[model samples]
Target: MTDLHAPAHPGASGTPVPAVPEQPGTAGTPGTPARDAVPAEKTGEPKRNRRRVRIDHLRHVVVEVREHAGYRTVVRHAAYTAGGARLLTRRAWDSRTTARHERMMRAAEAAGNEELVRQWEQRAYAYRFARHRRRVELLQMAINAPKAIGYATATGVGTLLILGFLITLGTGDTSDLLTPIEAVVDFVGWVSFLASVIWEPALYSLPLIALGAAWTVGRRQHTAPAWALPADAEDRDVVPDEGAIIKALSNLGIAPLNKAIKDGWQPRWVSPTTRSGPGWHTQLQLPMGVTVEMVNGKKKVLAHNLLRKPVEVWPTEPPKLPGTLDLWVADQGSLSGPTPPWPLLTEGTVDYFKGVPVAVSQRGEPIMGKLMAANWMVGGIMGSGKSSLVIALLLGAILDPLVDVEAYVMAYNVDYDPLKPRLRALVKGDEDEQIEAAVHALRRLRDEVTERGKLLEELGGDNTKLTRELAQKDPRMRPKVVVFDECHELFMHKEHGKEAAELAVKVMKKARKTGITLVWVTVSPTADSIPRDVTRNTSHRVAFAVGDHVANDGLLGSGKHKAGVTATTLIPGEDVGTAVTVGFTNKPFEVIRSHYVAREAEKGVDEVTPVVKRALKAYKVGDVWEVPETAAADVLTDVAAVLGDEPRMLTQEVLHRLAERNPSAYLEWGPTDLKAALEPYGAEQYKSGGKSMVSRTRIQEAILDRLAEADEDEGDPEI
Candidate 1:
């Protein structure tokens, strides 16, 4: 059987014949099938396309030549001449008319400053009037010039002749009269010869000199394209002039900005670029359909266009000039270097109400952070120097002896061990018990907040909020700061995470007005690690280098990343101590390099240890400060309470009574322990009657003296 769908079969001549299917229209009329009509000679032959090969080779050669140094240098020189000529023409036009004044008026109008607009208008009118007056005076002088010159010439000749005549009379030489006229003729001849000799050469060189001047100006301003500039000068820092700013804004990859620039829109300079600290500051009024946020989002691209590092370019929204961008471009490498030493290292004391200097802005301005009535959320990755920032804040708060400081580090890190004596509560461990302790600390802080609120209410008379005076007046109402370091461990704990987070949120919500500051330091910035409730209530946020935009917004507030205020831009190790903080400084936000205080083991004792010792020495033994409910009782305060109006008591008997009061705290206390505790207060036990006894009068007097000294040192507390 012959099958039409069968595979091809070999023929007698060793060529395979393909089977063809019968078609409805072509079966009876066609001589051969269309598929079998193709010629065998033209099958599978390679073709050479020489034209495309030659075109591609030519393109490669052209690219190579364009990238050569000589080619770039020639292009740069050509651009220099053109740019210089344009600059000179613009300068001449401005000087000859009121274009400069008109531009300033427009800038003032855009900035919404009516006063500046009026001032510029008056100046422009004065310029026009003065120009017309000068033209009229020139015409008048031309009309009267011939008569005045003739008269002046005749007067000068007559005076010279009279002098000559007098000399002739004295010397009796009649020819001397003609001597003055002959000398004048010779001077005129000499002047004519000199002018003839110099005039032609000066005329021939004038145009060349003008061209050279233009070239010099162009090169100085770096008006060439970036690709055409020399290799060494391509990325060099520019002066941040008007042209540079325009170029940066135009190339920011922003659609509206680029479109506006292409359509002949010009920037309105509300303030000219001026040197400010280690940078240049300027205010710009953007065109329609373009926003400061758009510019901010392209900060890295804009910085590269302006020949600067991304960190060096800062664009902010100006407070006074609404709808304008406040731009600050730092000097090359200024912000990347180390910040200045801490101010307190040499000599200083902090008053909590006045705020403390925690860090310095990139502009070298101090960042004053309010510790009282403020809660902070500090977030960063490990080794991002978040701990260093925490230490700086703690150092500032603890320096004020009246403020109570406590820290609970979830990890076994000893960075804060040197200040343990000054810290009311210093707990450091990764154990379950330590995490439980931190949870208990938060519970106690919540209770203290409630107590302080009631105390403030009792004061009455518009003292609705706690003030420095109130904190000084009441023993239990002093300013207290509680820090939970590596708080993610506590928040993510299997047993107590939910309860801990709830208590933290409650404390943060009510602590602001109660003179208690709650600082949560977390390594992970995920929603699970740091709850949204904590971040939302803690208005002041400090974020070091983080992982991504999600973490960035979690550490900072939502929409901060999109607003171009992000810590994710910060490099981890290089920008260890640097952070972007909001609601902490006078401005809405700032990028600051926090002051560092190293540990004693790292040879930083000279800076930190001295401050801690001073704080310890300044501590009042019996004065009431903040302490957790589970904390051990104060030895001095307990002794005073145990005395209870007794004239005197034996030391052994007092210890027995203290043991009854708080067995876990003072159960093992002996006469020696009692003496040791009272020694610092200057109210040690003394021999009375027959046995060693504690004096009630001495202890009471000591407490009164301590209170008096506090009042004297602090004077009137700042409100």
Candidate 2:
């Protein structure tokens, strides 16, 4: 009997055939065939006594196909269950079989065996397709299982409820979705009848919804005042996220951070906070073997990655945790706000013992330094507010009665012109005579340091250092502060360079005990311009925007840049008056913006001039001395006296005679010094008798020329 209940296999068109009914007692089961059974082959020959037997009830079958090489073989199997029949496995005979076949395939491919490559590719595709089909069947079973269905349904419902509640709360709506009582009442009212008729609950509840919304709006307005709301509600406060910052630091390719992260280490991020004004502050606990220096070295790259402008990176202190870095990111490219005005010194009693306010820190706290017993070095690139910082310090010093101010402005800037009357010595211009005068003043200060040291030693009570009590007892021991603006000019001078540098180094090292403060301001902070002897001994250092880290470290102490206090990050012109101050008492390193003193407009004086003048008048009585206004006339008269009764004299003879006339001023005068003094007056030095000699007639003519120019200047009317 032919069985008709056999399970169908796929036909040539890739479609399943209809199942046939099975015969009783002819196969292993109802729908499967016997495991050893094989299908009859169709032949073109006559058959003898052929029985049309139908096989059935096959539970599983494995078929193996082998190539002639005996090494390449494939095994395929199929299994059937109540769900349906599926391919159970399709695999190589052995693991090495595929590898060997791949090697042959590569050889064929390299030899351009397109036909062989295609045959192998088709075989590989068939095997992968069978495996993928099995995987998909298993995935489908898992997805459609009862547990998965129940879990997914619960998750979806919970998510929807949460979203609805959040939306209702955020919108401040008292709608049916959020209010249970209102929802029940609406459900039971005539609106329910309308909803049943219209087949839309939302449409029927429109009137109730409108009233609830109106009530919510009115209640909110009544409870919350307009003034309580933020002025700019739409403004975004874009605080930096810690996760984003770590990602940025990782992207910077820093070795320490990358290696730590690669080694499965994670940094602990602290909550970010707003800085006082222009920036944000955050901290990170770095992984072991990583350091703050490692992070600080890549500050610029980190700033680039974080999309912020100029980050300040430093190690954490106070609590002083190792491997901790504190990062400050500016809100914009430049620090916000204008420079604060110079504070008036008139309200309180002036105390030279304690410092005065010269600048403001980034936190807006006043930055004061003791100018009485400390030497100061101010260095920066040009136009970086070195002059302004120096002026602020000078204004602070001059306001005190105990401070005797002297300034040598080698640049001849008119900013210090108003201070001339109060200055013990004022030397201006970059000429040779001005340089000589600066050298002379430095030498005089060096001698005074010795004299004051002796005085302090003699007046020693508990301390040999000059105290306010000692200064009060002896008026001559008043604190002397000398400012050398553009001091590089004096240090780099051809003739007086060596002597000037030596004298400056001496004053900076030994003068602090004697109550003499030397404020040296220079644009160039290189070793050649300002020696290490002077830079290292100076008690206070302020650095403005410089060219590079080398200059920054030079101005601030060595290793300061590596330790993460750097001024090189400051912009040149935009960050004017902003500097890093070191050696201050309150803070080891602080960023300060010096008080700005505006330039005089016509006769209008600076904002600080009036206050300084008043302070000087009240406290600086009998201390201020007027410098001789006729320096040129006095020099010419001295020259005439030196060349008495002779048509001309040797330069040496003139110097000797001038030294005799004004020994205090000309005691150290040389030929070069004499020439520098008289050069502005057009005095001529000529060679006579193989010796350098000055002509008396030329000196007289020079004096007459100066008188004539003075007459011409007086003849012109004031514009």
C-alpha TM-score for every candidate: 0.63, 0.52
What's the residue-level lDDT of 645 in candidate 2? 76
Using TM-score as the measure, the top candidate is 1
Candidate 2 local lDDT, 1-719, one digit each (tens): 33455555432222333344443333555445433333233332222212323311221121011211221211111001210111111123433235434654564465355665665665555556666898899999887888888988788666656766776787777462445434445767877687678877667688667555544533322222112223343212245555446656666676666656545455665423335435566666777766666666777777666666552333332134445566666565445468656554334333566676677666555567677678898999888888777776777777666678898989867768766766778888999999999999999998898888878878884347887778777887888888898888898988999999989888777887788888888888887888778888888999999988778887888887877788888888778888888886544588888877765753565665675675467453465432212233277788888798799888877876665454335645676677788888889577664467999998899989988999999999999
Model 1 off-target regions past 4 Å?
1-189, 196-237, 248-273, 282-299, 315-327, 603-605, 624-719
lDDT per model vs. reference = 0.77, 0.66
lDDT of 1 by residue, 24-50 (tens): 222242233433422333543222323
- Which ten contiguous residues of candidate 2 have the minimum total lDDT? 74-83
Pick out the ten consecutive residues of candidate 1 with the lowest summed lDDT: 44-53
Q: Please report how far candidate 2 places residue 48 from its true position, in Å.
A: 62
- After superposition, which runs of candidate 2 have C-alpha atoms over 4 Å from their true positions? 1-237, 268-279, 311-322, 330-334, 345-349, 601-605, 619-719
